[model samples]
Target chain A: AQSVTQPDIHITVSEGASLELRCNYSYGATPYLFWYVQSPGQGLQLLLKYFSGDTLVQGIKGFEAEFKRSQSSFNLRKPSVHWSDAAEYFCAVVGAGGTSYGKLTFGQGTILTVHP
Target chain B: EPEVTQTPSHQVTQMGQEVILRCVPISNHLYFYWYRQILGQKVEFLVSFYNNEISEKSEIFDDQFSVERPDGSNFTLKIRSTKLEDSAMYFCATNRQFADTQYFGPGTRLTVL
Candidate 1:
């Protein structure tokens, strides 16, 4: 079985500051990873996803995540945080083969608070 | 841009009552899914539907839970007998193809009183 762990429960950063949210996963093989964001009372929006190729994958809203196989991590990062970026973020992983389609194991999540 | 849409933004139902949450996925999408998030928990996948049938489901989707695409556009999740634990924000998502990018709709908040 695959699982995901997000070490940070909450993080606060000032506007224009750099931000990083850590995520680690346990999977037997190369996995498909994704990052999603959800504002209060809103549906989750996909921030980025990593299937293969480059270790660093860029996504919408100027966000990016690096897939580190050695560490089993896919941490999301943004160079400059905007106030609007404040939201709860989740890291998820899906297994590689059979029975993996649409099966996503999500991390507990990390709430981000951006301040001016 | 085309997007998934869910109905009844908020639903309040008594425990043991039946409730249905509806969604209309993007017209061309071939895969549809239902997920739920408890008030303070991570989102969990409940079930996935493809080719007009269920392709996969989680343990959370038991006999009490069922999904249907009664029409060409509308997909629904029906809870036979709701429990307090079932109270959560239910989301509907669709992907152009299996294992591809998925787009989510505004969730329907179900409150089982």
Candidate 2:
């Protein structure tokens, strides 16, 4: 079955520290990966997406992710964490084969807490 | 930038009552979708609509759940009978085309009593 895994349920980082959130996916074919952020009581906002080419993709709010085909991982990274950056992050994948239809399979989200 | 919009930021409905959640997707988008996120859970896909018909739907979308475009620019999801388990945040999203980026609305919080 096509699925996404977010290993961490919660992460804590101090302001000005670097942060990394892990994400892995299982699919038969090349996958379309996306990272979304959801603030409290707000809708999910697209942070970045990787469709094809350029394994390293840059996203808004100084976020970036690298897609590793060999490991089937698309992990998000940030060089510096800010108090406002604390939120829930989700990793999702779109199956590209016959069963795929633009529907996203999301993993259990990772919650980030930044202390000032 | 155009963003998807949903009506009634919050709705409280009684059990067995029918409720319709309305949305206006981004104009010029060809694909529309509805998803729900139960509190403290991952967002789950409900259904996708294109060309005035459903392109795909998850198992959770059963006989009780229906989606309609009704007219231009408006998409709606109707649940025939509400249940306590039905309480969740419903989000409406749209994309210009398949395999493209999707923009989501603020979401409607449905509370079934």
Candidate 3:
């Protein structure tokens, strides 16, 4: 079965501190991974996605994620945390095979809190 | 910078009532999808629509759930019989093509009593 797991339920970081949110996936083949953020009362916004090639992919809002195939992990990272960056982050994966067709499997999201 | 858009930011209905949720995807997008997030739960995929038909659906998309692209600019999801468990945030998403990143709309919050 294809699934995504966000190990952390909640994470807090002081402003200017670095942040890392863990994500792990279970899939039979090379996976298409994505990171999305949902602010309160807002839609899920795509931060970044990894389809192929580079292991480290840069995203919007100074966010980046690295896809480690051997580890089945695609952890998201940020050099510095901002109070505005505090939101719910979700990790999702497309199913294996041709034309996955937007049927994304999402992980239980991690709530990020950045304290100023 | 086109984004998917959904109507009626919030809806309140009684159980057993039928409800239709509407969405207008980015004009050029070719794939459309519906997902629901129950309060405090993970977002779950409902169905994917492409080329006027459903391409895929999850187990949660039961017989009571149906999706349609009635015309050129609008897509819709209809729940035949709403239940208390049906209360959730329904999001509409669109992508330009297969395997492309999908853009989501501000979700519609459905509250069933």
List runs of model 3 lying over 4 Å from the truth: A96-100
Q: What would the per-residue lDDT of candidate 3 be over residues A1-116, giving only the tens digit for each residue?
A: 68999999999999999999999999888788999999998999999999999999999999999999999999999999999999999999986476566588999999999889
TM-score of every candidate = 0.97, 0.98, 0.97
Candidate 1: pairs in clash: none
> lDDT: which candidate is best?
2
Q: Provide the overall lDDT of each model, using Cα atoms, as 2-decimal numbers.
A: 0.93, 0.94, 0.93
Instruction: Arrange candidates, best DockQ first.
Output: 3, 2, 1
- Residue B46 displacement (Å), model 3: 0.5
Report the lDDT tens digits of candidate 1 across residue range B1-113. Answer: 88899999999999999999999999999889999999999999999999899999999999999999998899999999999999999999998776777789999999999
lDDT by residue for model 1 (A37-64), tens: 9999999899999999999999999999
Q: Summing lDDT over every window of 10 consecutive residues in candidate 3 chain B, give the lowest-scoring window.
A: B94-103
lDDT of 2 at B67: 97
Which prediction has the highest TM-score against the true structure? 2
Worst 10 residues of 1 chain B by lDDT: B94-103
Consecutive 10-residue window with the lowest summed lDDT within model 2 chain B: B95-104
